[model samples]
Target: MTEPASARRITGAGIVLVFVYGVMALAATGRSFVQIVREFDDAPLAYGLSAAAAVVYILATLALMFSRSRAWYRIAWIAVIFELVGVLVVGTLSIVLPELFQHPTVWSLYGSGYVWIPLVLPFCGIWWLRTHRPAAVPELAAAAR
Candidate 1:
């Protein structure tokens, strides 16, 4: 059977988005694991932030992958927006108060460590979520009316 228009949209370019998020999740997880295990004392704040970034990436990837559901779509929005905010806050803090973050994280220096992909990915995610939102189910729409 053929998929509906909404499903196709959700799984179309979204596939690429999912792929990128998946890669980010893996990279962040690996980086954070090494940093935290190797030298938590060297820069607890920076390594902790890296671990948090990994969790956010993992959540975003899962939310996007399961975005066919309305709840998951909203979760995707939350995750992506949170990621953008995190990158901005962490990036600024790392620069303005370098002492606080003795070590660089995935989001440090505006993601300079990762070629700024961390800074740019959230914008792309937000755009994709807005463009490919799943259509409301008729039952839900009727209930809301």
Candidate 2:
């Protein structure tokens, strides 16, 4: 008489959002890897921030794409919020202190390198999640019990 824990399904717009997240995750990870390996000394803060951004993107992608659980849903929200804050703070700092960053991070100037996707993605994520909520996985339901 109750909806199964695994009843969640990503439909319509949800699939597009997941694809975008996947792209962002790959882009950030690749960018950060290059920066860390090739020019870490040139811009430690930028490189470090890029790496951190990549990790957040990866987590977000995984949380949304793979899991259909209440916990992962919460994680998606947290990741999206953190990403928004990171972009805002880093974007401001990059503009205000141009000299502070020898190199730009993924969030620098609100993702200028990627056509502002970083700036826009979080808002989209929040909206999409709100509109297309997923059901919990069976494992998660059992754990929650």
Compared with the true structure, all predictions reach lDDT values of: 0.91, 0.87
| Candidate 2 lDDT score at position 129 | 74
**Candidate 2 lDDT, tens digit per residue, 1-145?**
8866455467667788888989999999999999999989999999999999999999998888754667788899899999999999999998999897759899999899889999999999899778766655678789999
TM-score of 1: 0.92
How high a TM-score does candidate 2 get?
0.85
Native-structure RMSD, model 1:
1.7
For 1-145, candidate 1 gives per-residue lDDT tens digits of 9977764655666788889889999999999999999999998889999999999999999999888789999999999999999999999998999898778899999899888999999999999998878888999899999
Model 1 clash pairs are: none
Best model number under lDDT: 1
The C-alpha local distance difference test score for the whole of candidate 2 amounts to 0.87
TM-score per candidate, in order? Answer: 0.92, 0.85
